[model samples]
Target chain A: MAVRDWEAVIGLEVHAHLKTRTKMFCRCELEYGAPENTRTCPVCLAHPGALPVPNERAIEQTIKLGLALDCGIAARAIFARKNYFYPDLPKGYQISQYEAPLAGRGRFRLPRPDGDREIGIVRAHLEEDAAKTVHAGGATGRSVGADYSLVDFNRGGTPLVEIVTEPDLRSAEEAVWFLRLLRQTIVELGISDAEMEKGTLRADVNVSVRRRGEEGYRPRWEIKNMNSFTFVGRAIEAAIRQQVAAHEAGEPVEQSTYDYDADTDRLTVHRSKEEADDYRYFPEPDLVPVEPPAELVERLRAELPERPADRIRRIEPAVGFDAAVELVTTGRDRLYDRLVAAGAEARVAANAVMNEVAAAGIDPEAVDAGELAKVLGARERLPRDVYLEAVARSADPGFAAAPFLEQEAVSDASALEPVVEAVLAANPEQVQTYLGGKEGVLGYLVGQVMRETRGKADPRVVNRLLREKLRA
Target chain B: MAIDREQLLHVAHLARLELRDEEVERLGAQLNDILAAVSKVSELDLSEVPPTSHPLDVVNVFGADVPHESLPLEEALANAPEREGSAFRVPPAGS
Candidate 1:
């Protein structure tokens, strides 16, 4: 697995089964865990003479993704048969796109913990999925002595959007973030559930490693069996490391499809390039070119929802406090929208949503952020006794956020500044202990005076005033 | 030149097409003719025409995320050639 005098280049082809109700090309319900092969039909099961009619919902879903990803619409898409013979494929050829994909040259921006990074989304295309097959035994599924195999059509015929990424990926962590962001975007767009654990989403990572300061990249080995984001990232790292060793040792790495062993976390050769060319592509003649009208595309584009990245950025500055905005921005936008819809100021709602509601798992719909937000934002219109109650327990968030005004005292501390100075000038006993950083005695003195002030003085102002006076 | 019979058989086997010798011999000549006929496209000034990936703009459009009913066991297993209860059994492999 050595790659000499080269750099590692990585690209990904991720297929996401849009959580749709029906198969992409048929009316068969796309419900999972149905009795195996029960959802099959002439069109879905690929019976001869059964032509695949495009699903309107599938088309619209793909278009919505294109819009969210900021990709141009493909007005005419020709479906070609990727000619391949396999036990899983009922039809000798799979209907897919080659010359014209649904959308291409798209880009997506991933939100990191600190900043946003842009990744090139090469293209998003439409294609029918093949049935599921269980290869028996070993890590290869067919590697060991096998007795038999199983087949499940429950997952078959699900419409998948194949998102191809540019080979611009550098590190494994970045790739993981990119996948997470993509999944998040799809979920936010309501386009796909994109659960990789459930096989609703899957990724194929292509990796090639080269030497440091090399001009050309090494012959990459395509890594497969990466079912999860962490797995994909780990596989890429392992592949790069393996190739780097090969390069350092002046050995060349061959182009191959390697399997990522999640248990031991290493790359094993699944099949070499010579053996991997079973995917014989040919134009599918039975399925005609899908040419949805241009006006339909226009309508979909017009109805496109604002992507999360765009929507989040616009909402951040609307709050006067940046932290409030930032905190709320991390949450589900639907919840935020509901809060705003329920007569909450975006800013106060943002704060209450982040600070108060998030900590508690109350069904947001049951207790909308608006009710608590109104109390916090409209304290002037609220009862004074309620505000006072909020001031009393300012130390405890649960106390302050008990659906009450959270403000406490600033007037008393400043008013007590002169009195505390006079007291300090007269005594000078507790001053040294306070100056020695054991300022706990200063609170005792301030509390005694504040109690004398009949709680009329602000406790915070009193504490500050007493502390300054004691300092002298 | 006559189509090479051995070369055609090799390709057919790789593609997993179980072809009779006569059918293979005929398809070999026919495919070469088709390829030779369509090779004229390369001679044309078609470099200016950018390839169209999809004619429609719908790639990511989705509906209100909701669930529907799955097929009943009997209905789901109706078409299976070999089924016990709700499962479809396949021919045993590696025998």
Candidate 2:
């Protein structure tokens, strides 16, 4: 097939949960993965006469996030009722930012470990989440074609921040980088737990393939529910193929929504019944406009943490960390602070966190991270034995590390010599293997020595002793 | 000029509107009146006024890109009208 000259112009609409205690317009808890619908209330459920009041925390966090994104704060913002209905929406109309969003055009700077590529932000607005619905009598038994689907209002009332990006992404990798950096920006801003799989972070991908250098833009399809970056990459690739295929088939690429099928790994059409419309947005009429003080916006700006891109430059030197910048970029600032707080040697701690804790690819915030502050601030109060114990239990925590360290204390570094020598004597045959150039044989000898010493002797001593003995 | 029943119903469908026939007829007439009045904004000498998409000048409030805990796939899709695996499945276009 003759490959047509096409470029996939991608934009994103990412909805993230604000790390607030309440929902966007109600008092319901802003939690996820709780018992379905447990985080709902009459106001969030949209019962009649329930006048929605904006959650202040969500607003403030939204402001802080806007500041971090470098968005020019709106002189005034407002909440409007987006009149729409779905099984998940308890309210016939969702209270959202139609005319006056909490924030406006902001720029997110994503430091491509590869280079200095700053992604542009179109806008980041705060809004309320919709209720959730489960279908029956469908594919996967979720919507199995029953008379009705199950509805959960747990997320319905949650405070959400919707970030729409300009179509500046030239490649899927850039798009993914932008999304990752956006999450890092928000996390550092303390705005939200940007988890894509948890719906705290969700992406609606707008992909339009044009002739590589063509202008005016082609009709694009919006891909929804891409939960993982890996899947996002696949979905983009699939969409590109579909677009090229459609164009080759002489089909007019229609403007519509499509979904990435993880099963088939293909892009399928969603709604083609209507083209994108002028939302006819106007100043909302119900609630008062959210006129945040211009001074407050400035205060937020003054309080802004050094940008993540800058932090990587400043702290990477101080932390002397070595790894892909992306690994540390998301949680690096907080992770570094936590290490300093834990009183662990900053470089050492940064190494473990960057490679071990964060490399697990889990959110360090989600873990019991209070230890970081404890380790940094109170490590002196904790006996050196306790410090040793903490690192020992990295893989497990049932055994108290301090007592174990105390009981297995070595009589200083030299005490390791006799144990190492004894182990060498017992494993003389293995010593021959080490001399024979099987360096792994030395590991067996080291373990034998540690076992013989009841793990009381330091392993480094054992290693030195074994090395000396084998060389002899 | 009054908006017709068919056009009203069509707009409603595009907006995912589920309105009764009589309500559609009523909305058709009301929308026409509103549009007729709002058309004056287009007639105004406002070409120099910069159009604004957002009232607030704030931008770039991003979250950490790290993946947080997600609901089990079933839980995420449990509320969908149709679902396959972790995805919410909708009925075939006509169904």
lDDT agreement with native, every candidate: 0.67, 0.67
- Location of the lowest summed lDDT over 10 successive residues in candidate 2 chain B: B59-68
TM-score of each: 0.72, 0.66
Error of 1 at A235 (Å): 1.5
Q: Give residue B26's lDDT in candidate 2 (0 to 100).
A: 73
DockQ (Cα-based) for each candidate: 0.23, 0.07
> After aligning candidate 1 to the native by TM-score, how far in Å is the CA of A174 from where it should be?
1.2
After the best TM-score superposition of candidate 2, give how far the Cα of residue A27 lies from its true spot, in angstroms: 1.8
Identify the runs in model 2 with alpha carbons over 4 angstroms from their true place. A1-6, A31-39, A138-146, A248-251, A271-282, A315-327, A330-472, B1-95
Model 2 per-residue lDDT tens digits across residues B1-95 = 45677767666775777998678767777898898898868888998996654455653332322223434545445444554444334442222
Candidate 1: misplaced stretches above 4 Å? A1-8, A111-117, A136-144, A271-275, A278-280, A311-355, A363-403, A406-472, B1-7, B18-85, B91-95
Best by DockQ: 1
| Candidate 1: TM-score, chain B only | 0.62
- Name the weakest run of 10 consecutive residues (lDDT summed) in model 2 chain A: A392-401
